[model samples]
Target: MNRQAQAAVMFLLGAALLHAGATDLYLRYVKAGLQPLLLASGAVLIAAALATAWYERKRTRAAKAASASASASGTGAGHTHPEPRISWLLLLPLLSLILIAPPALGSYSALRAGTALQKPYALGTLPAGDPVPLSVVDYASRAAYGQGRSLHGRSVRVTGFLALDRTGTPYLVRMALNCCAADAQPVKIALAGKLPPVLQPDAWLEVTGTYSPKATHDPVNGGPIPYLSVTSAKPVPTPHDPYDETWNN
Candidate 1:
């Protein structure tokens, strides 16, 4: 590839990265904490692109001046620079990012093996609120390791996509990210009652339910997981930030 083409590609890549980081698009794939790094890298790439252009322009001008002087003296021979083919693969990622704009990890991603639930922090008094909002990761932690004792009488709310186990048992599931989607782990809760007829896999919903600490088998990992006795549920639009990060209070 010629220097110009390489420089252009770099610029495009940087711009795409900057755009993703500056906007909410990045949150879908990784934690929001990466924004600053993304932006800095993008700026560096753009600066490098500009430097490449300037250096190429100066070299071109110098070559032109030398050729003109030699031609005037009728003593110069033609000089040629080899051009190499640029692989089409170079454009694939940029095009994909611009056109498709891939979504974050979802149900299919959650189904992958080797993923496990994230460990929760030390327990504290339940946060204030009736049917308080609780993350799937938090609920799972309190349910299994806490012996379901901490959540015995408290009603909590959780939001996640609808899914079904092999036995067709309905449940709520969410993938929490430790870094990016590559390390995302799925946290699930079995819904204790019938769900609305229209519910489908990947359909986002918020449910208000009580935690049942009764010992139960975890279909995903074959260990104990928390269960929710769902009292009420409703469809909700997919949240802009889909991941539950450890740093959140």
Candidate 2:
């Protein structure tokens, strides 16, 4: 290929890698840890493409000089050489993308949503016996803040997968993360009333309940035990975009 063609091929390949890397970073890290690396890689690739173009231009100039000298000497300049082709270089980025497509975050990570994390205090008193629409993320965040302490033992409703524990009860429920599973926290809630008729892991449900603070008693460490209490449990459907229960973006 001529200098222009070679430069074009390299530029395209670099651009492809940059795009693939960026997509993977976003999907896997959710704009958390992978963003800096993605940006740096993109900058490097652009610089490399520019450098390649400059080098190709110099090579073309030298080739032209040789051709002109041969013609001036009345030599057989009719002997034509096929241009070099570097189109294969474009495959580099394509191969990288195929090899490293980040896997979707799945059910495995949802189990780790709330353990060891301090539940949130309620911002204010919850309405008693009144149905309130709530997001799983909001619920989880509030629980983390203080388990709705401000709600003053009022009932609240939350929807998510019925992550049943080994005891066959809806004790430790969870939601999956699309990217990082390691950070998943199990949402622990005390089932106040009777257990659901069909308790199954990964089954979706909405639970309505009153907030009750359980006394803390920690055996593993000297620190005080975390309060664990809630009431009025009811089942509901899994929300749309189940993977991202938080809906915070």
* Winner by lDDT: 1
Residue by residue across 2-74, what tens digits does model 2's lDDT show? 5566566556655654675565434443434445666676667677778888987888799789889988998
My TM-score estimates for the predictions, one after another, are 0.89, 0.47
lDDT of 2: 0.51
Which residue pairs show backbone clashes in model 1? none
The backbone clash count of each candidate, in order, is: 0, 33
Candidate 2 off by > 4 Å: 1-116, 119-129, 136-148, 172-184, 190-195, 214-249
lDDT of 1 by residue, 61-145 (tens): 9989988898899976686777655564789988887677666666665654323664556766788778888888778778877
Q: Which candidate is the best by TM-score?
A: 1
